[model samples]
Target: MTASAEYLIALAGNPNCGKTTLFNAITGARQHVGNYPGITVEKKEGVHLFNGLKLRLVDLPGTYSLTAYSMEELVARDFLALERPQLVINIVDASNLERNLYLTIQILELGIPVVLALNMVDAAASRGIEIDAEELSRRLQIPVIPTVARSGTGKLELLEKTAEVAAENRSWKPLHISYGADIDPVLDQMETDIAGSDFLLDFYPARWIALKYLEADEQVINKGAEVNPELSSRLEALADHVAEHLQKTLETYPEAIIADHRYGFISAVLKAGVVHNSQRSDRLYLSDQLDQVLTNRFFGPLIMLVILYAVYKATFDYSALPVEWLNAGFTTLSAWMQTIIPPGLLQSLIVSGIIDGVGGVLSFIPLILFMFFAIAFLEDTGYLARVAYMLDRVFRTFGLHGSSVMAYIVSGGIAGGCAVPGVMATRTLRSPRERLATLLTAPFMNCGAKLPVFAMLIAAFFPARHAQMMFLLTIFSWIAALSMARIIRWTILRGPSTPFLLELPPYRMPTLKGLLIHTWERTWQYIRKAGTIILALSILFWALMTFPLLPDARKSQFEADRQQILSQLPEDTRTSLMQPGIAQDGLTREIAKASQRIRAIDRAESEATLQHSYAGRIGMALETLTQWSGFEWRTNVALLAGFAAKELIISTLGTAYSLGGADLDAGMSLSRRLASDPQWNRLRAFSLIVFIMLYAPCLATVTCIAKESGAVKWALFSLAFNTTAAYLISAAIYQGGLWMGIGG
Candidate 1:
């Protein structure tokens, strides 16, 4: 059904309520996650057909109150005021009745029909506490449905009540907290002033804004003045009068009175409706005991490390076989395509460019999927919150909030695989400075695209001894991130740390369905990006290496030189050169024949064209810049093209090093070739690895950073810093190696 024609149902609630779970259960696969019109905070919408009516459910971000202090509060208020959904499913936690009810009262003031879903009734009941749902329904003048959303209980009843409320088209009267005589006169005057103003229609009530103005809520005052200039001055006068009469500060008077009234109302309601048991139980005592240990000062970090290691080992070991199978399958398919298609540009495009480039990168999907699953499981089980608690002390020293530790850890493992969510996760930090600090350091983590480069380098340079080297490098990345985070925190994000006030959510068994869905969403993102950006870059790299082939004179001269050398060689030496040993004879002959054919083709091309073509000129330019680091022109070209996408490094190597063979691998592997080169050794290889590790993030990562941070400047800064770091480190390592006589 069209959006305009569908019945709109808004899901609104306080933070930590089961609103999200209820929304997910009701809508299932028909959900789209986005953001509010003008805010960075997330907005979720889902559509489902119930009783022949298409219900469009919009899940608003969680907020504590309708005070308009935070962006989320403003977005929630604006959506309710402007969009005016047909029904609001107000999900309130049964355990935290009073705090959740404050938002309910404010929402009721908006004159919208609300169906209360008293969620987490089971948790409350398990604690030997009970709420009379019927009494709550009567007192609030709304249909109250007690729900255990985690298990999908009372969902149908809740939906039925929501539809009933929507069909009735009823609005609840505003419930105002009565301020005593001291401030009542000022509130009345402000109300009159607001009612007489031309912009009165733009707001709910001038008295509410005036009350917030009296509380010195700068956000509300600014917004009110923007809507009606007269309102601000008049409200300011009213606030002054109230403050003077009450003998208190303007900010203190309103908040104190409002909170007292709210608590009083909640107390009265609880006295009438709730039954609390006195006895404590084994489960409660056990949970308390566990919390102490899990959130302990010492054990928490140790446990977190063990958990992280387990996740990595599981992802790496379990996915290795599947990844290998996928790579092998793609290789075989590419080889088959070469055999079917004659040796030409089309065959090169399909085998070397498309398959070896894109397909090679895509084969790592299983690993990505496994990692995402493990992350989702941790998130689902609520262990992530404890992780945040454990890292709070250390993170606070860096000027980052404790919550940012999770974002840093997640982003560090898989950088740009999906930075948007990593950035979004920063919302858990209360301090803006901490959030910005986390965002800046997040992309420094090695991402999935860099995985293939690391794998290739490790295989080539270290061989069977590579695992420990790989682990050391991974740890080094974290060390670098920690150091950078500390630097940025002190220099750029300097400020007082906010208090740690995170909620330790109860652990729940993770749902396999939800875990799988989240895993697939992230994995699908990687696949889509690889198909578009990575594939384009790979094809472009292939084109750069292929066109305007080698100079005819250069090729002929080299071939003639090689022929003369072979002709002059003794029969024994020639036999050794030509045939080699029995084991190596077949593969060596194939390579020799392929090299001869490439020479024949190069001899037919023009010198000027070969020199001026895109690849040659680009390589020449990079060679000038990279000479200090000892990179040959060809290696420079590959590294330059690799910035678009790291996987392209392998593809570029394949194309540049190809010897007119049916199989790309028939030529020396990029690793083997680099290792054998006189100019490169272990030291240069190590430096190159560090360069790749610290270089500018791929195109997708930069795009994600731009989108998430909402500034091109920050993305540019990340690129500049990372690229400079890579270059400086590589230069240092190379120059140091030369001084030590390790390499030329």
Candidate 2:
């Protein structure tokens, strides 16, 4: 393409157009997902090798048009205009050609080399519709390849055509379409002034900029004003004059006329023997027939609930044994480390700080894996979109836009997502108040970080009803988020509800390869976070719970008690009992009795030392207030660490218990130890789950909320409001449960 070995190609299309499926097919596992610079919009890049040439493919955010109405559109437009990828594979739905072509027309107007991917040809064929790709391509003067991305049909041909286009090394030639006599004169004058002055020409073509102004695109108008106020003012006046004249004459805005013309052009092209429909007009397609029942007002919500419960039940049932296996493996590893390392700071650091702490979080990978698999399955099947559609009715009642459903889902409304992306996803909302309300309440959803904590507590306290507990938690999170959104909307961020339009994609069976790739991508993110952030925080919290050792007098008292017990025993028995793992082996009755007593002393000494440490003291200080919610000093420390990252709750608790000598025998899981703790019970565990689900989001999420909302005050409000509400509600539940003698 450019005499270099690597060519950059951008894959872009409307959402639900199989763009991602095609990208995955091309790149397989060679992909990286990250945020665009200075924005949280996800940037996906992958390498595809063809004909001994490495082509780098960037999967741009899915958007309906190049107009900057949402963040996705902005990112896609900026990448194309600024980065100028060598070629673009514009994926359009073959079954919905007219609607999808709107974006294609906009892309072509940008003057970049484009190859139209008429994706979902099989779906179109299933509906008795046929597309003449050569006819369409000839009309548009570009390659049009029919593809079924889900099954890799026509994939090779699409890539080859894209490579040929890139090799052409063509200069950009902006497409021109007439918008009738009313606006064409003004548009031409604006374009001439724009080009003669080279105004904002570095990033956009002259005619394209003129069209943007006539459309009243906010981002373009603002940029034009910044670049040259006087010229921008003249152009704006011309655009306004044309807009007013068109509005008065035709009762339509410039953008409306522009869209009508674009559609007009597409219609003319298709009418020229480009598309053929064999089905009767009255016949309903398969997707519409399915939607009749799946999106029914009465049956849709019920079916969604049933489906969600099934997902939870399957995940828990399938993951339980693997979770136990991981727990056993970590416990064995911890014990092995203890046996190899002598009893000292080194042993404690490895056994308690690193092993016990990180292992607690790691043991839940099976659950995370299964849950992610379920989410990916639902997403790939397009059922999640229906969930959002059904929930929109309920969301509207709670002052949330239907678009908010996606934000919540991405935040784990279904229960395996994250708040950062959920917060970032709010960029799609047009209403400022609705967006703010959504982002503020989004963290209440059970994100992946909170998943380990919930899984551990449920296993320890509600073992018999894993799926039911998770389902109820999902229900509770939705209730909490919606109720809070209503309150916030009616109070500080007051606003009337705006309309929401959602496009439901046709359901396609997910390929095992795609599902596994998605599952691993999400699960690996969870595991990676555990290994990095959670590991570091675990070590830090461990040090806080381990340092400032007991005073010399207190240490001497415990040492004296140990020696006293040892002195009374026979020298051989004392020596044998002192060695690790020997006390559990053959021993006389008297020696066994003495060993138990000494072990009790060690537990007491360790407890005393923990109480004297920094984290313990902090927890103790908060106990007076938090005890009302059934949390003790140890639980308080764990909750404190949860603010940094929710996964740390399990790890911090593990470290705290390991340091406090909570009867951690080799191969005993953290849940078992927690279950056996005197201070923990069903009521307390449920209360803790409630608090963790509703409390302040992790620091990363708070930072994201701030960045997305463009204000630190809202972030602070999220933290303060969430924590306060969580404390009050959890305290009420705990106190009420105790009054009723329920699991007290």
What is the C-alpha local distance difference test score of candidate 2?
Answer: 0.90
Worst 10 residues of 2 by lDDT: 576-585
lDDT, model 1, position 81: 72
lDDT of each: 0.70, 0.90
Question: For model 2, how does the per-residue alpha-carbon lDDT over 143-257 read when each residue is reduced to its tens digit?
Answer: 9999989899999999888878877767887778988888788889998999999999999999999999999989899999999999999988998998898888989899988
| Candidate 1 local Cα displacement, residue 230, angstroms | 3.5
311-427, model 1: which lDDT tens digit per residue?
Answer: 666766787688777867876786678668876679777876787777756877887788788877887677877777777887777677777767766664433244444665676
Please list the Cα RMSD from the true structure of every candidate, rounded to 1 decimal place.
5.6, 1.8
Tell me how far the alpha carbon of residue 605 in candidate 2 is from the true structure, in angstroms, after superposition: 1.9
- Clashing pairs in model 1, backbone N/Cα/C closer than 3 A: none
TM-score of 2: 0.97
Q: Which stretches of candidate 2 lie over 4 Å from their true place?
A: 1-4, 582-586, 662-666
Deviation (Å) of 277 in candidate 2: 0.9
